[model samples]
Target chain A: MIIMVAIDPSYLITQVLNGLVWGLVLALIAMGLALIYGLLDIVNFAHGAFYAFGAYVAWQTLLSGGNYWVALLTVPLAMILLGLFVESTLLRRLYGQDTKFTLIFNFGLMLVIVQTCRFIWGARGKPISIPSELAFSVNLGILSYPAYRLFVIALTSAIAIAVFVFLRKTHVGMATRAGIQNREMVQVLGVNIGRIYTLIYTIGICIAGIAGLVASPLFGVYPEMGAEVLIPAFVVVVVGGMGSFHGSILAGILVGQVATLPIIWEPRIAQVMIYIFMAIVLLARPAGLFGELGR
Target chain B: MLEVRDIHTFYGDSHILFGVSLEIKEQEVVALLGRNGVGKTTTLRSIMGLTPPKKGTVLMNGEDITHEPIHRRAKIGIGYVPEDRGIFPGLTVHENLTIAADGVGAPGGNYEDAFKFFPELGKYLPSRAGRLSGGEQQMLAVARALVGTKHVLILDEPTQGLAPKVVDRITHAIKGISKKTSILMVEQNTDLALRLADRVYIMRDGNIVFSGVPQQVRDNEEVQSYLVIS
Candidate 1:
């Protein structure tokens, strides 16, 4: 059965809005990935699993009659704790070792976490009802859209701005940024490089966690949902320069547009469009759009 | 005061320093001179705990600190200005100095004094360090290490690649800084080393072949043969 696609103004506006929200969500995940890679020099294959884990934590909190706002705050914090545990238990050992060691270790971690979530939450998808305050539609002169979608976009933008300020204005943030450039130099300057590594890893995954928590109501919570976003996040990181914060956000939005814009003309082709776009961009820039050579 | 006694260091099983030992007294400027690949840098690395010595004692103010990590050594008042200068090119000059100011060392120090030492750094505070001239970058590196009130400053090839005028400027800065804290330096420019160093130790093949006052080192033929004259 053919599902008819419409190209009306309202439809186009709605798609663009949806794409923006999804792009920002992807940006959130990719930013963490980029930060981790930049500082810790780890690809963090288990990031998506951590994302799913956060959603599950949010689901658990909400299911226990906790407020939506509380779950939103608590979920990322829970993810940070989980991140700390994961770092100290596993990733810490892999630091300063061969890159392949972390790659294989995190790959194994992804499987373990995915399987653990399946065992706990079951294989079926779980739905989280949108908060009542955000259930209404928002009208913006030219378009009417779900208020929740607007909230997601606003929240992500705020987070991005906050991160920018933290990295630029604060002393700890400066040390972290310095560590990204030269870990040994930072260490010799009396900055605890080991602690910085743990903090960055935790912060990275917590951002992923927040992305999962926010996306759960829209996308549904499922064990394999993380697997879906994880691959796209990889694409986003590649399309963006590895370790560039600006590059990840731009690439995420670009991927988001490429993924959805084509759906108006041909629904079937939209799925592969992102990959094709990535390939084309990579062919032109090689290291990615903003990727530094040899980074 | 700082002391490294019979320290042995390795780079992945290839021993780079064998039983290397040295001493710096209070407010003394000591220079380590050697030909290329003779473990001058390795000695600094061992003292900094960047490459922990396999066997030996490192003493800071008469306390054993051989097992301390790099940051701990810094916290205990050892400031290292590395061979490459170790400037974060992506960060601005102000950011570079700010990071070191945020670091732990002698208390009650800030970026103002650093800028004062290298007045040229004030103009480039907003510019990325990578864009700075080599002399400007070296100034920034040294200024970064000196941002805090450190007890001991270890400089590895502080004037490795700089113009004569810039080298003279750095030499003047070192003279000013040496009055505040003890310095252990590794220099290729023997003339500059002799000028700044109260005493000199010459290393040959990871071992100290000569240790004497600057005038004594200037008079010795054996140590002169191992030195890199500039």
Candidate 2:
């Protein structure tokens, strides 16, 4: 028996746009992971949990009669405060310890965060309606695309650019890059590297929080929502280069296409294809596309 | 300006410095000379609090800083150029100097003073530090220290792997810097150390074996016995 299916060109365009949107969201999460890893040398397995927490918080805000704009404005600030607390209380003690210690700690922390969400919000997924401003679709030459997804792409791109400028142009940002390269030297040069560490960790967490809040309207808020994206986001980071900021952006978009394009063919194999692509890339370049060897 | 009094330091339980002591007065250039593995680098690390001494005090301008963190020690006017020069290879030369200056709240015009010592660095401001030649990197390291240092600068083997011509340039820069800030340096090149230092301390087995003026070091038999050079 032969199966014949007709594929629409507009559907392909829609899938590509969807891929871009998802990729940008992944880039935000991956950048946070990269920043924390670059400076602190921690993999931060709890990053996904932080994402879930942000979504839940946004959901809570909206349910409490606050608007989507309010959630967007306040969620990152809340994440920053939470990040400060977590870094000082838990991660600080593991600074000089082995990397595996942080891995295990973050893994456990992820479990705690997920369970906390379950206790407070229950186990069902919470839906967030699209904001009225972005509720409509924009007509492209080939297809009509969701305005919210396009907005996500634009906002994320702007954020990525801002982060790049901050790292390259500002004093604290220069120190952060230097610290990522050589933490000891930055300290010896009279920078309070500890403060840089706290700041970086908090900023990273805040970014993850923003990504979570932004994604919630589409993906819905749930205890396990973060875990669903965590692996793919990690793949983005690894493929981009562990600590390279620009690399994450490129890899995120690539992985997003790899994730979404395959759905047009076989949806069941889409997730497996990501890992296979990662394996091939790792085989070709052990350091990933942009990472320095032995970094 | 700086005093290390009988400090004991270890590297994860393997003791590297045992009761080592040294002093640097205002605007004086003091060199610590010793054979390899005799704890010269360890002495510098101890003073910088990279490896905080377990038993003694590190005093800066009469204030004890034995337990102060590395950055705090640097903030209190301790500029350290480690054995490997400690240049952030990924950063640009301009960025390297800027970070050092900002760390200590040095004036914006400090870059010009640093450029005065090594004018070649001015041309390489936008280049990555790792791309610089060894001599340029050493110059950048010293220049970086000069930009932020208020009271004293600490150097560990600044000319370890440089060419002779480069060594002469560094020596000239050191002489120029000495007029501005106190320096505590470790050197294997006894002749160069003696030429640039106002005072010299010789170490053997993590302890100060001999210390005196350059003339006394040349004339003394005991100091010669400790050092490889006669």
Candidate 3:
């Protein structure tokens, strides 16, 4: 019981960096979930399936002789078309109905997507090697870290900032924020809410698609790949406050650390630590860290 | 310029408006007055297509628009200031006006015109709307309507909860606005309605029981009884 052990500072720093990289990826995915829920009021149980589908599509592109850069460029655009089709054909009919209908519908959609992926690609996971330019590690002051992780961090930060500016500055972005608060009033003010909904849903899917493609090299591609991150992403959204953009980013980083940092002392608790953190946060402030009071 | 002809509206299975009919001519202020639960707001909702009349028609410039969507109605130059003010509390005053301006394709130059009515809004353009005082929010609501096309403005109880001082300012704004846009308002304050309106219609049991000029309403004791004015 009194045994003492020395820890390597470099290993600890590496783990922390890993956590940061993972968190940013989670933030990107969770932000999509938050955007769809904020404006459409749909819980979107199928969001994770969309992520898995994106990864598979990227894999297929690579198999057809497309490089990682090409897959990245085209996958999100393809997801936009899929989003347009899904929202207009299926999700459009569910608006104005009970929230339960959409939830159940999305749950069914998720099953369909996952099973379809399994049938097409088989049950085995598919590997996607990192791009040649980013295959090595870069030396930080404390330790060397994979260059791809650094690229992910920089790219995600840029995307987050771009989305923040879009939401705060542009006319359509302002209408979207307004729609989140009061959709009927937005309509009364003469904004076409249906078109706004379509655009938001498309953007949400596109972001999730991008997240999937970006994370594929690290985790490989599989039918159930999205299922692994979906629950944690939900945790990030709830901890950050549902439907809050800034909250998702902050909570994503926090949850990422909680999920990863404990591995040095106890590897068994890594999976459940995020739930514990969420429970403590909920106990302190039931509305979540960034959610509005009484929401 | 706007007419509601024998419109009947229902919420789910329960009927709310029963064959209500009224009209507003070019640049005229028409007040629709009735007691609570008498379907006064429902009549306005029917015209705005918030609750389309199941068995009637609403016409703007002789074109039927009863089935038109709410945003379409607004885009075609029908500005509404709902009973609750309908201010987007999360947005800034400038953003609120911007939405209305964008909705009707109102030019950026019209923002100065809106500010002229309530210069107070210009100072708080950056502040969140929910943080505004009751009087200021009302001014912003009226100012938002003015930023639109000014074809026909529908107001529901714009002064329901404001102070008398605020009421005076709102009254002044409405008086100034009436010269440019046609107004169809449902007001609880009979004296204020009578003062601002060129024409008045009294409703009871979902029907227009009386219609005449403001003086005719004041002189008639029966119309006063329906409004229950002391």
Q: Tell me each candidate's TM-score.
A: 0.93, 0.94, 0.95
Residue-by-residue lDDT tens digits, candidate 3, B201-222: 9999889999999999889887
Instruction: Select the stronger candidate by lDDT from 1 and 3.
Output: 3
User: Lowest summed-lDDT stretch of 10 residues in model 3 chain B?
Assistant: B104-113
What TM-score should be assigned to candidate 1? Answer: 0.93
In terms of lDDT, the poorest run of 10 residues in model 1 chain B is: B102-111
* Docking quality tier of model 2: medium
Winning candidate number (DockQ): 2
Instruction: For candidate 3, write residues A160-263 as lDDT tens digits.
Output: 88888999998889989999888888888778899999999999888888889989999999998889889999999999998988899999999989999889
Query: What is candidate 2's CA lDDT for residue A30?
Result: 95
* Model 3 score (lDDT): 0.89
Residue pairs whose backbone atoms clash in candidate 2: none
Candidate 2 stretches greater than 4 Å from native: A1-7, B107-109, B219-222
| lDDT for B63 (candidate 3) | 94
